[model samples]
Target: METAALNPVELEIARNRLESISEEVGTALIQTSYSPNIKDRRDCSAGIYGPDGMLISQAEHIPLHLGLMPTMIKNALATYGADRLVEGDVLITNNPYLGGSHLPDMCVITPVFWQDELIAVVANMAHHVDVGGITPGSMATHATEIFQEGVRVPPVKLFSQGTLRQELLSVMLANIRTQDKTRGDIMAQVAANRLGERRIHELLEEWGAERFAQSTHALVGYAARRTRAAIEQLPDGTGTFTDSLEHDGNQQRDVAITVTVEVSGDELFVDFIATDDQVDGAVNCSWAVTEGCVAYVIKLLTDPTLPSNAGLMEPISVTTREGSLVAAKFPAPVANGNIQTSQRIVDALLGAFHEFAPEQVPAASSGSMSIMTIGGFDETTGQYFSYVETYGGGQGAMPDQDGASAIHTHMTNTRNTPCEVIEREYPLRVEAYQIAENTGGDGRYRGGDGLIRHLTLTRGKAQVVAGTSRVTTAPWGLAGGADGKPGSVIRHGPDGDEHRESMTRFEVQAGEGITIQTAGGGGYGSSPAAE
Candidate 1:
């Protein structure tokens, strides 16, 4: 049952079936989750992997999650060999050094067995609101090491032999800020994996076990062939480019991430050996995240329409130096790397590709995630509240079309929390929410405009932590276009004073308001054409 024997019709059917299982897993998690971040914003991802730890199919959710999941699965398999994985056993991990993006993003892996033989592993990753840290959100902006960020769970069994590990679960719940929400979200992820197992079993039953195995191989091979053909079409040469992070989250200094993209024959190589050393701040990222960024950019460049699997990455290779910004070593603070540095890696890749194909590349988008977290205790309700959300910004203009306005671009795909929901859930008032006027750069195709959000604390005191970028080094334009406006975070006291801070944590009293102006995207070309 080799891949070469499978016909095109069988391959397409098999590919769709495998992808649908992953999609169904994500749908179940979203519908059953309690938090708005997962239920409404959909910050989770699901995927199916082969028995040999190769990615088979994934849902079109978070690119960061989908890309790093395969490595996490392989690491899990390496830690506890296949002989140790039993039916109804679930493995969990969030250690960045051990194939995780960040502490808050927990990866859940469950093996599916058919006739007592391991068939596949269904896995899902969800960004929990809190996992215990100095800050309420568990994503500390000023953390100098990984220990201060959150609980770093290594590869371990969360469920064993069809029974929940109550002690382990209790330890997890005891460490986080939001116990009920975290527990509910984790259980939802568990349920999603269970559903994935059932769906995979159904798929195996429909197609004979041997046929299913052969089809999976054939589909992956087909995708690899298609990607190689696409890569062969590009010009063969080395294109080197560099991009920067606005700050290291601890100071106003910049950290550079460089990429040298080489397209030789039918294969592509991305090397990050010359990037800056890992910083002490939360801006550093793990090697898994850097690999995810490269895989995602390659997928986007070669053929986005191709089915996502290990085969798509077959013709691509990524190299990163140890302890570098793109491949930080153990103990490096990396909470913001998953959110902020991941975006810069993509930008660097795009920059490298732009050297050969400028028309195919758009100007820079709102490069930062515009992260803001507000946590405090409410006297009226006699309880505590912690709210974490990322605001959207302008998207870069394309060659022929204008960039989308006030939207999440590139790495992150989460939606902004609606003002109605924010006011209803937290002790705050939405003073104003609108698109910033004249924020987008001017060009033949104008870049998108950023958003302006004004929030006022209603009662009690609140701690605000903002980890945003693209303020000092604004999004760059191309082909003579002007750069976009820089972003800013301003604190307006109840009386009259206004203060500016880009990346810092501060306290706010009742009646104080904060204004966030997200950066706009760069334009494509300098022309006074109708936009």
Candidate 2:
């Protein structure tokens, strides 16, 4: 069938329509989810992919989740061949080795069919609060192996031929502590993907199969051309930088992450072969996450307005060592790696870019996600409760302006869980929530200030996990700027206040409280005082 060519106006319309569908899908997931992590913090992502598993459109959600969606879909298709997937078959998985960032992040994928032909796949990923791990949340700081993180779900059919797989769901829920919440969130993900499937079918019907395929092809090609053009603006050269994680839960030693970025003609190459080996802690990320970080930085530096799809990565190449921290092997604990190591990867890559494009790249941000999780049994409700959240810190200063205060940066784009929601859902109270005054680095354009959050166990005992970074090593500055302040976690109990490591898990009794202070951002230029 010959397809009609799309004019610029028609192409733009198609792009907006597809992007809007993804956004709508995300909104549905958020509104229907049962956990605070998904509904309140919006810790979820949605995207549409081609039949061959290439990303077509995505919601402006978490960068880490959005980047890894295509990989997850590809792995699912590989396991259950596209030819074998029926129209109503919905697949699910959260295996890091199988293209997932972590175990808690569950991926729900549904194939979209038109006229009995597989046209595309609509998918969404949501972070479940508890998935039956050693800790309250699945992101245990001391987890040394993948088995200890949470229940690992490989690519399998959650719904076949429009029927729910009750046995499969029962086996999954049996392992989770907060089974009701997890079950609700999982169904919400299914509903979101179903909505996406309907929207895609409507789009295909309106545009016709031939025109729809042609328009999508045109959209991807346009993104590729724009990305290549942006790369062409850069001078051909190679730049290198190294950054480190303060600790990996099990040890206080630093884990190094190194990157070398090469710009040639109209192409960009990123190499992480010099990075350190995977350690015994939970700070090692998989290759999918490494690719996500690289793609994020490239899109950020190149053209923020370009359509986000597989085409944007056409001019980019990323290479990582098989057993390195950026590309860990099986059995490696990777709960915190998804949140912490990914941030450091962005910092290192941006530092390397700063060497050549000093004017274009800003200084480093907080370089930490500052994740905290608390889980306990609620006597009043006769239910198990798990609370998980990532606090925002300082955003790095730009060349012409100051950094933003207490905001999610880089790979993470989630909002802070509201205090009311926290107190109502968990056996904890928000004692203090404010900005740490003067924590930002001083420069021509000062860096942003970090946040201070204090939470006290309201009743009974609870388990707490603090997974963070930027304690031993601070966010680096560019030009003549100064490094940002490091982060810290403290416990206030009957024995007085004790400091915690970058990644630690502990038990807190009633009346005891925990304080989390995130890291500040790096300054852009030297201050007058230093001059």
Candidate 3:
């Protein structure tokens, strides 16, 4: 596949240049987006792909987004062949069956052309605030079907021949609750892709197409070689483990997600056949998410610093039962799958890897994103509002150091919405935000502590929907370390009474409040029993 020979030094420079372009695209999306989900929380990702739909470089964004980006690109290419994609043409999609995490994560694809020859594809995925659903925030916990979650967008041309599809845009905006912000966020993604297109064209002009292709091929090969070397260091055996979701929200039953990782020679295989069948709730995930989770853990174990591209996944193979919870079929609600089940997949992978490489894998993180959404009307403004948030809990302890506290770990890498911003935007008051004491597991190096966020409604009625897990099964410890405390969502009524709830949707009257207590990381290393 070597079109032209390039030395190692030259290859490194080219790699950095491509990666820098992706980083710039990500920055453009964040700076231009209007929603706090994209702007403040930074729930977005950007990447550059080759003409054949292979990921070349990506920005340091959400792991779930980056890992599944290639699939998204390939699906577009397959639906509308490469010959159909011309300069100034862009594709938009959030179809869960076609390489999408959920409906809210809209992906924009633009083909970069130089001298009328297609050279690359620049794409980005951003979590829109709303896409028209029964729920206010579009994250319905009890959604039994995909249609109940949000609007479903297949791979379609949002822009064709340098012209905006105004009709298409208008229709999409008409369905969602937050039309203005959603429109801004979509255009922001377009802007990011356009910027990436210009940068790629400039790179091609500077180095010529042959040199650019040669350097990218060389860079991918280098990453593959590094990953293979890392894989060869591990023992040849199979490690199996099982972790679970306490409840799927549809029924009050535990859902187990199991994995068996096989490492042989320079190849690694991850199988998810031991998991439970897909439930009728919103926790089921598409196959793309399951594959992405496998690829993510392999990268974590082998060479996290290696170039994040398709080549790094060359030696890894994934297998999943078609109708399992981790690989759910069509029409299954997956609103919480991407955020909640994805975390449990990582935990299962870590559990398996701990069998042979305990030092390489950290103990379980707070095994949930702790999603909390409160939506209601602001009588002061006479407009409907939905406040959606995912809180960071404790990070699992490492063998050499203590875990980090109050941080987003694995799959999710988003910034927190400030207390001031939440209160300013919504009719809510920041009652108390503090670190929950005695939450982390005790060990030689204790796990990090979780946090508590208590918010009170200033006025009007509201509906609270929470999608969370790890309430019954605590984040497990390693090497005899103690287990961390379980997390819970508590409602403090107007009469001063409090109670715990799980995956629930209820009404909150004025003066009522809710408190979210996230879980802490499990400790690492053997220690005596705690008093």
Candidate 4:
């Protein structure tokens, strides 16, 4: 099973199979999990990494994972030293500075053991429904630091020498609000990791460990070269784009972001130099997340055939201004950091790149995550429940075609929960769920249409924690296309009163109804002369 003797076609196939292992792990995490965020909202990612901490292959997971994961693996290796790991053990954490992006996003790392040698690590990171923060959903808009966010687990052994750590398990169950569900979700991640580990071992047995390791490295090198070539083709010059966050939870100040990309013969220099100061809100992000955002945009601009590993980001250089939203200082909160700002960063970089490669890039996308937090209880059944959902939006129109409507966008890969499933799981009713007509930005290729969802609070009081944009600044069109309509929210009270809602958290009392409408992306070009 020498590297050369093995069929090149087989080696490629093996790489693809390894990538699929990540998706399989994700499906397991979703199917057996207890929380909607894990099973329904689908805020998780599963991927395989080589012994050297570069991504091997993954099932098409969330866009956020693609940007943040390479660094996460590096953090894992740095913390554990990679040699102290053993068989039948799992490590978990959600430290923002470590392999984690935030408190809610729990990163689970397990080492793949092969004949008493360390070969690789199978890891899955998901947003737990609750982790004992100030809020039930663990989504606090006003937290000031990571400590206020939730439990900060780092590379701790859930299982040691093949035995479960019951004391640690008890502590977790006691701390989290959704105890039973969180416990089940944690085990689900462990199960998914084991599944991938078994598959990795099978591949090792078929090709032997040495050849497998060699192919892994070779594949990464191949991706890096291809990414570099993509950069080389772009005209040699520096271009910049800027966007903004409407406000922090304070809702009084606007946060800005500026990204300049220098393309010079196979090299890309990306810098976020004009961003604003960080705030005491859950909107700040770390340097790793910022780098991930840069990497994610390059992936969108590069050839899809290229492997998406750390190598693809190797030749590209990224630098950010200090005290900015992308590069937050310590003591700032960032529970929703990955979703709140990463997509905007991607959009900003693409905005500049489009000026150089119009044919290669599309117009602006649905620039916000339709994050909704709902809480209530079923009166007839008398069971308590509160949950949050981060929905996707329309994609931008491309050169050859129109964009998708009411779909996920930018750095997310989750599907909306079915109306039927929502009814069965909770005491809420989907009054209206359809495309918001006229929401797409008009162009030669029509922009994607956005979604409108109306629901009734049937039981008790419910709180909606919303953090979205495009309500103030509509999604922009390209090459003579019209701008898309802005997003809107309306709440109808029991007394037949209605109120327009802003982008913040508020309460919906019993007998009240709520409606949410998301915005669409802009089109690339104007329509051709009417037949």
* Each prediction's whole-model lDDT (CA): 0.85, 0.89, 0.86, 0.77
Per-residue C-alpha lDDT of model 4 across residues 29-105, encoded as one tens digit per residue: 88888877778778889888876577887667786876788787878777877778888877877777763577778
TM-score ranking from best candidate downward: 2, 3, 1, 4
Comparison by TM-score, 1 against 2, better one = 2
* Cα lDDT of model 1 by residue, 101-165, tens digit: 88989888899999999988999999887888888787777899999988888888999988999
Question: Which 10-residue span in candidate 3 carries the lowest summed lDDT?
Answer: 494-503
Alpha-carbon deviation at 158 in model 1, angstroms: 1.2
Query: Residue 310 error for model 3, in Å?
Result: 0.6
Superposed by TM-score, candidate 2 places the C-alpha of residue 169 at a distance from the truth, in angstroms, of: 0.4
lDDT of 2 by residue, 245-340 (tens): 888879788788999999999999999999999988888888999999988888888778878888888888999999899999999989999789
User: Which candidate wins on lDDT?
Assistant: 2
Error of 4 at 471 (Å): 1.0
**Which residue pairs overlap in candidate 4's backbone?**
232-266, 444-525, 444-526, 444-527
lDDT of 3 by residue, 1-531 (tens): 753666778878888999999999999999999888888999999999999888899999999998888888888778878889888999999988877888888999999988888888999999887787878888887898899988898888999988999999998988887777888899999999999999998898798887778877877888888888889988787899999898896766789999999899999999999899998889998878988888788878767887888888888898899889988889888888987999999999999988877778888889988888888767788777778788899988888778888888888888888899898888788898888888998898889998899988888988888777777779988887778888888888856756655577777887888988889999988764551
Off by over 4 Å in 3: 528-531
Question: What's model 4's lDDT at 403?
Answer: 88
| lDDT score for candidate 1 against the true structure | 0.85
In TM-score terms, candidate 4 sits at 0.93
Worst 10 residues of 1 by lDDT: 494-503
> Which candidate, 2 or 4, would have the higher lDDT against the true structure?
2
* Cα deviation of 448, candidate 3, in Å: 0.7
